[model samples]
Target: MQFHIPAGVGEGMQLTVSGKGNTLGRHGGINCDLLVVIQEEKHPELERDGNDPIYNLNISIPDAILSNTTEIPTAEGRAKIK
Candidate 1:
C-alpha cells in the first residue's frame, strides 16, 4: 500500500493515525490496526475512531504489505518507525 505524506511534514516529528481499512480475504473490510514506534520505543498506538485526527508525519505502513498490491506512494518523511 502506497502512503502519500501530506505537505508540512517534518523530521523527528510525532502524529497520530485514526482509521485504516484492509481487504478481507479479497473483499473490503474493517480498517487495520496502526502501530507507531519511535526510535525503538513503542509509543502512540492508534485505532479507527470517528473523532480522532489521523496524524501525518509520525506514521507509516509496512513497505512489504503496502507494495504487495496497494499503489500508495512511499517516500522518506522522517525517522523509520517499526
Candidate 2:
C-alpha cells in the first residue's frame, strides 16, 4: 500500500485512516480500527544507529589502495566522499 507519510513521522508513530480497516457490520459498527506495524528491512549498504545513518561502503581493491573518492547514495541523493 502506498501511504504518504506526513512530515515529522518517526518510529512507533501511529497513522490512522478512518473507514480503511476491516468491516464490523455484524457488531453494528460501520467502522473498524486498522492497526499497522512498522518493521525495518535490512539494507545492503546502510544501517541505522539511533537517529544517525551508518553507511557500509565496499570499495574495489584498486580504489581503496589509491584512496579515491566514492559516490554514495543517501536519502537526498548521491554524494561524493573521500
Candidate 3:
C-alpha cells in the first residue's frame, strides 16, 4: 500500500495506520492497526549522522587549483557548492 511521508523523517521511525491491518478474527470483525517502519536507502556519496546527511566531496588537483563552483547531490536535487 502507498502512504504519504513528510520531509526530514529519519530511519527506524515507526508510523501507525488505524484499521488498515488484517481482520481481528472473522470477516466484518474489528480491524487491526498497521505499523509502518521507515527504512533509509543508502546513498553512494552521503552518510547519515542521526537526522543529518553528510556528503564528502573530493575535487581533482587541477580543479582545486582553480576555484569554481561544483554541483552536488542533495535531497531536493542537485546543488552548487563553492
Candidate 4:
C-alpha cells in the first residue's frame, strides 16, 4: 500500500486525523481522537542537536598536526573538508 506524506513534514511534527479513535461506552455515543506519536530513529553516523546534525570525525596524530583534506560522510553525501 502507498502512503502519502506531506512535503512540509519534518521531525517532531505531528498530524491529527479527527474521529479515528475508539468510542466511549457500549453505545458509541462519544468518539475520541487518535493520539498519534511520531518518533525518529537515531542515525548511526550523526547526532542531533536541536534541528542541526553533528558529525564526529577521528583523525590520526599525524593528520591532525599536518594540513590535509579528508572526505567525510554527511546526511547529504560525502564531503571533502580541509
Off by over 4 Å in 1: 1-16, 40-82
- Estimate the lDDT of model 3: 0.84
- Candidate 3's displacement at residue 60, Å, is 7.4
Q: Where does candidate 2 stray beyond 4 Å?
A: 6-14, 56-68
Superposition error at 81 for model 4 (Å): 0.8
TM-score of each: 0.22, 0.55, 0.73, 0.51
Alpha-carbon lDDT, every model:
0.40, 0.72, 0.84, 0.72
lDDT value, residue 72 of candidate 4: 82
> Any idea how many clashes model 3 has?
0
For each of the candidates, the C-alpha root-mean-square deviation to the true structure, in angstroms, is 19.8, 4.7, 2.6, 4.9
Per-residue lDDT of model 3, residues 28-70, tens digit only: 8898999889998888777878778888888998888787789
Per lDDT, the best of the predicted structures is: 3
How accurate locally is residue 41 in candidate 4, as Cα lDDT from 0 to 100? 70
Off by over 4 Å in 3: 59-67
Q: Write the per-residue lDDT of candidate 4 for residues 1-82, one digit (tens) a residue.
A: 2234565355677766566778878986787776555677767788777767788798888888886889987877789988
lDDT of 3 at 1: 82
lDDT of 2 by residue, 7-48 (tens): 545567787766768888786677765666555565667777
Better of 1 and 2 by lDDT: 2
* Model 2 quality (TM-score): 0.55
